[model samples]
Target chain A: MHIPDGYLGPTTCGFFYAVMLPIWAVASKIVKKTLKAKQVPMLAIGAAFSFVIMMFNVPIIGGSTGHAVGGVLVAILLGPWAACIAITVALVIQALLFGDGGITAFGANCFNLAFILPFVGYYIYQALTYRAPAISNRRVLAAGIAGYVGINIAALFTGVEFGLQPLLHHTAAGQALYCPYGLNVSVPAMAGEHLLIFGWVEAIVTALVIKFLQKQDTNGFPPKTCGNDTVGLNAETTNGRSL
Target chain B: MSFFKDSVFSDENASKNGFLQSLDPRIKTITFLLFLVQILLTRNIFILLCLYAVSVLLACFSKIRLGFFLKRTWVFIPLFSLFIAIPAIFSIFTPGEPLTTVKIAGLTLIITRPGLSGAALFIARVVTSVSFVVLLNITTKHFELLKVLRIFKIPQIFVMTLGMCYRYIFLFIGIIENTHLAVKSRVGIKIRPKKGQRIVASNITSLWQRSYQLNEDVYQAMLSRGYNGEPLVLNNFKAGWQDWLWLLCALTIFITIR
Candidate 1:
């Protein structure tokens, strides 16, 4: 979810920006070094797809519409480091172009959606499907589970951020100047929605895509092994170029 | 599908001759950022209303339709914030004088005076902040916004990635939409979830392959043009006297408003 301006106080926003700067720098360096010059266009395309993927409204049971975040999907296709850069680029573009997220809260948004979601999702997927062959159904299920868990974790962090605002920043009258909700309210409000609705949407999208792709191409996901070779633990490390 | 049209990047108002459109992107970004910070810091509801009125006036001067601008800014974000603000109006959250009371099933809900004021201020801040961001977006070109980010010493890699991404986003959208339409035409029968999943997966896989193929084509094109990996940007920023005057006014307002 995109956090708008005035949601978090200046101090909280600043803290996230400070924390994310180094992570972004490291991610960029890893991506530039591992990816070939030709792969630049592909990475850009991936970032663009990350931006547009949210537009696809998935029809679930109960006649409700929800969208997939596509953060973990990018990580499954590309490496986690590349996913970090790609999703961060998408978030930045969304903030600047659409004002979907806040200008001041960009760092906090990126930290939640880009860094925490993809990295956690990728690692969890790897841990679960470590020994499974790339084409197996279990690996596909792993991707789904990973997507579900990753986004929920990110939402939890955001809930904490919103919940902490009132406690951390207030006027002398004990009135909240920023988000007025405390931990008890904000955490359940954020986590409940994601856990019940959006998490399932993300899981279904991820699982279906992975299954369909594997059926089409017997070689399966991660068509290349560029960055995956360097980070040998990921199970998606097959024989395709970085997409 | 909403993906059929690009709603995020609005350039309809940017082409029009307006005060905000004429301002330097750098100046617009900095001053508006200051305006947002100031709005957030101020706890006084009347002062918040004044700042919001000023934003509305700025929108009018920018020559954007008042209804269109308000709808664009408030339709989604502020509406969502309203739900977040709802709990703040009850005395259970913030202690204050009881404006009214409601009881249901042995539960007492008191609408406190301070709670209502607090929620109102929160809404005011959200409304004002979103207004500034929406104004900046509607007035400036997408590329110009990316370029203005350079003024803040944002990473060049980010700028390059964003520029390239912006260009291909339309292309990818075309590819995706065409695939969906093609699938719809080809399938005469009502498709089940399994078939639907297969179609979506194949579409994504094809798109990935196309992206990689396009990447090779772009690489060859760049190599043929003697281009290096480094991105070369055209710096055409010329800050006029009016831009400076605008910036100065912004600073004065930011300071004096406190």
Candidate 2:
């Protein structure tokens, strides 16, 4: 779920941007480490794929269409950094070309989906994979849950970030922020709605894509242990390359 | 989804705040983030209402239609927040001062005030937050924004993808649309597409395969053009008079509301 600009108070967006930019800078370096020449186009194309897939309202729940950000799937195929950048780029294009997310909220949306998806989703994936067979169907299940959980976590971050807005003024003015809707209210709703359904879809799609990639392991980037230009990090790097 | 709708949300009064388009995306980004965090911390209804009102006014200044925003946001965000509201609705056990309660089979089940208050609070927070998000999306561009991010040294790898994804989103959607068109042209009958969902599914699989191949070709073309990891060099855009004025105005109004 893209958290557009101007959604929260000025101070809130400002603060969230402050926290997110540093992580994003780190994300960029992570991207550069494995950015072989061959993978550049794939990164861009994948970003585009993610945008369309996320925004393409699949008619579900009786004409109530739903779309996903394709975060987990991007993480699976392209590694977190590439997926992160790709999704960010896709989001930007979506914002500029179609007016999907806001201009001011670009940072917020990118932080929520692009940064959150790949790193968090990938980490969850690794946790699941570590406990599973190297190439078992259960790994697919793990990928699904990881995908689900990663998205929810991102949504939670958005809620927390959103929740922190009024607090900033108090912080700025040396007072206390109010708490009308406790973290209990906003955080859960964000996790449940923006992320939950997308999580299920992401899990399924991520599982299938992972399964598909597991079969070929050719068209995508090579594992890092391959240790060369050809050996771009794949989905597994999400665990703890900790770049 | 219409893939080019975001360009519409750029400032309607660009004549007044020209340099907002030129500010470092990173700084602008951080500013909005502060907005999100601050709003979330506020438990005061008065504060929330003030924030919500300011958000709406910003949209109005952008010259966007309120009806349009309501139609867009209410449809997805508010409508869906019912999930949170619904669950809280059932957890009502506290006795109320004759508050509205559901009765069944000569048994009266009281809807507690606290539970209802919780639900209302949940709805209000979600609506306000989501509304602001919609507002943000309505006002910015993705590339310029990401470039702002690039200033923070966010990797070119990720930036590359954002650019690619934006370009290819439209391309991929085009493929889907064209494929659908071709299918429609051939099907030419009274059969509902739903009845032939399996056929559509198979077609999608093939389409995915073809798109993959097409994507590879597109990559080759990019490389042929000497494409590197970095797609576009981050151009410098100075924060001018409008940028300062806009920022000051926003801050002043925000403080006043608070």
Candidate 3:
């Protein structure tokens, strides 16, 4: 979900930027140490894929169409750190190139979509599929659950942020400075939508992609070490040295 | 998707000879960013409306369609802020002088004067801020905007990543469209949901493999040109007096509003 401008006050936006800057710094460092020349294009393509995936429209239960935010799917295919960078890039493009998201609220959007969504999704996927056969249906099930839980948690965080705005910043005459809805209204609106509708979309997308990945290349998900053969699919080509 | 085509339309506008298109990208970016911040700083409906009027004037000078701009900006305001601001319009959220009262069933809904103004101000701010962003994007080329970002000292790796990502997105878009068309052809009239999902999944897998192969070929090409991590581009940054004048005008407007 893209949080537009004027929804969050300057204080809240500044705080998120403070938190996100360090995380982005660490992400770049990790990405530099772990990735190499050949993988650079792969990372770029992954970022592009994350950006384009949102354009896919799927028919929901009500004959209405909606798209999934493929944050967790990227994390499952690549690592969580790379997913953070990819999603942050996608969010930036959306803000600058299109008017889809706000410029000041970019940090807050990344905090939800980049950090929380993918990290939670990746960990849950890892935890459930641990010691299980890589090609089994159980891994796909775990991915689905991870997708469900990950988006729900991120949605919860967004709801809390929206709810906190009115409480923290308001006029002396009891007028809200930023977001008008308090926790009472904001929490239910955001969390309910994600829990019932968006979460399932995410879960279904993640599981389908993971299943396809498993069938195509069984060794794609559990990427570990930094060499030509261990990064991801077609490992033989990723021979660029990573320091 | 119409959303994809929207960018194509904006790109066409970016190349047009117009007031905003002629300005330096760095100047346009900074001025728009300042305008966005000023828009966010106020909760006054009048001032917000004034800012929106100025943006509309600028859009006119930029030669973009005003109806399309208004349609894009207004459609989102109702969908997003309307729901959030609905509770604010009632006395339950922010109590004030009751403008009107209606009784439905057992409950009374009191529309408050201050609550109405508060919701109006919030929606106004959102509208004004988004308009500035829309104006900037529809006017400036994407690469020019990225180069302006580089001037701001954003990390090289991040900028590089974005550049590469921007190039590859078009390729992936084609692949996705082709795959969908192929699936539609094979499945005939009515499509099965399960089979559609499988095709989408498989397309993603093949896309990944193709990206990896493309990466190898691209990397080798770069190496042949003696490429390292840092790609050196010829920097020909020259800011004309018009750029400074635009910045001064933007600041004057901000100060007058403040």
Best by TM-score: 1
Error of 1 at A162 (Å): 1.0
TM-score between candidate 1 and the true structure? 0.92
Q: Write the per-residue lDDT of candidate 1 for residues A1-243, one digit (tens) a residue.
A: 889987898889999999999999988887777767666776787798788778776766665667889898888777788788889999988887777888788889999999999999988887887767657888789989999999899999999999999888876655777888889999998899999989988888888777766665543335553245432124354334322
Q: List residue ranges in candidate 3 displaced over 4 A.
A: A218-243, B77-79, B102-108, B188-196
Model 1 ranges off by over 4 Å: A218-221, A225-243, B1-6, B102-108, B184-202
**All DockQ scores:** 0.54, 0.22, 0.54
| Model 3 C-alpha lDDT per residue in residues B20-47, reported as the tens digit of each score | 9999888889999889989878767788
- Residues A1-243, model 3: lDDT tens digits: 889988888888889999999999988887877677666766787788899878777556755556788898888766788889989998988887766777888889999999999899988877887666656798789889999999999999999999998788877777777888889988998999999888988888889877776666633333432233323322111223210
Ten-residue stretch with the least lDDT total in model 3 chain B: B1-10
Query: For candidate 3, what is the DockQ-based docking class?
Result: medium
lDDT of 1 by residue, B162-247 (tens): 88898888788788888888877888666665455456556666776677567768878877877688778988977899999999
Interface RMSD of each: 2.4, 6.9, 2.3
**Which pairs clash inside model 3?**
none
> What TM-score do all the candidates reach, one by one?
0.92, 0.63, 0.91
